[model samples]
Target: MIKHIVKDTFILQRLSSVATENDSDIVKDLIDTLEANKEICAGMAANMIGINKRIIAFQDNGKITVMLNPEIIRMSDAYKTKEGCLSLEGQRETTRYRSIKVKYQDTNMKVKIKTYKDFTAQVIQHEIDHCNGILI
Candidate 1:
């Protein structure tokens, strides 16, 4: 089911806990919400839907990808950019990486490590920051 976007900074600022197999429902919700808002949004964190879990869904190529308990293990080629959130009023300046290697679990709860670059990497970094309770 698609959920309402959460705009409460207090709730968004809270650190998200690790996701388990039981939180599979949240993955579905996140993907659903991301698809619903795809016209204006490229990515979404679990916190964005009022559930503080380490889950994120984002546009990858022409499809939506979900990451559970995502952690950025390595990042390089940093640059400054401005970004706007669906949960925020306006754009904010922040640093983003051009490339990142992440460790995360898939929808089936299997661990996977992957490298991303350019816009995709930036989107992942933003969502991971949300999991860490850091807002731009």
Candidate 2:
């Protein structure tokens, strides 16, 4: 679907829903779009591309990974960091965990749990905030 990014703050503030197996195509599209725009987009939420589902696609070390219905189950102490979004202009100081334990479904809808740290952790946190309708 490689849709355009949504910049409407009112729209971005609305929460997204959990994605299901039926949304595999949507997830793929998001991954493609994210990778295509990796220069400007570190990661993206489905809502950012006009799909109102709880999904995110990100690039990690040149590989793209998708997370459906992602939630941060555990988080370390918060630290202030600068972050920007595809839906917003300019970077701002945001508080985020240096490490996080997340539970999310893969493209196949299989639940997976993983811990992320450092920059990856920060990127995941930023995208998760988008899934939750929280702007940075």
Candidate 3:
């Protein structure tokens, strides 16, 4: 099912249960929403489709990618970043890995791997944290 949780409510933003062979709809909904909303994410500098923690910024690269139930497979040394979450309303200090490699299922249920660093790392880590039930 596609569960769109309320932002800043915090409780609803948590690690999701692993998708079985059945959850194709949830994945599809997220992908459709994300792909359709790329322009708005760029315009606002942030996009929150489900929860603020799932919010991502569109890079100038002209693609909006959505990872369903993404998991971080690797992480680098810790670094501090001033973070902004749509749920939190403002920036806060959060220490997190400086780089990460994530594996997520695409809309078609094909697993995809992507590495992230710098600001991209920040956003990915934030989103991953949401998958783990942490709201910052």
Q: Best candidate per lDDT, number?
A: 1
Candidate 1 per-residue C-alpha lDDT over 19-133 given as tens digits, one digit per residue, 9 for 90 to 100 = 9999988888898899999999999999999998999999999899999999999999999999998999999999999999999999998999999999999999999999998
Cα-based lDDT at residue 106, candidate 3: 61
Q: Candidate 3: which pairs clash?
A: 15-131, 15-133
Clash count for each candidate, listed in order shown? 0, 0, 2
Which prediction has more favorable lDDT, 2 or 3? Answer: 2
For residues 33-87, what per-residue lDDT tens digits would candidate 2 score against the true structure?
A: 8877889877889989888899998888878889989999999979998888878
TM-score of 3: 0.67
The candidate that wins on TM-score is 1
Q: What lDDT tens digits, residue by residue, belong to model 3 across residues 1-136?
A: 2334246444545544565446555445555554554443221111234533232323425665656557789998898777765445677898988788988776566888988877667767776666566766
Which pairs clash inside model 2?
none
- Decreasing TM-score order of the candidates: 1, 2, 3
Q: Show the lowest summed lDDT stretch of 10 residues, model 1.
A: 24-33
Candidate 3, residue 14: lDDT? 51
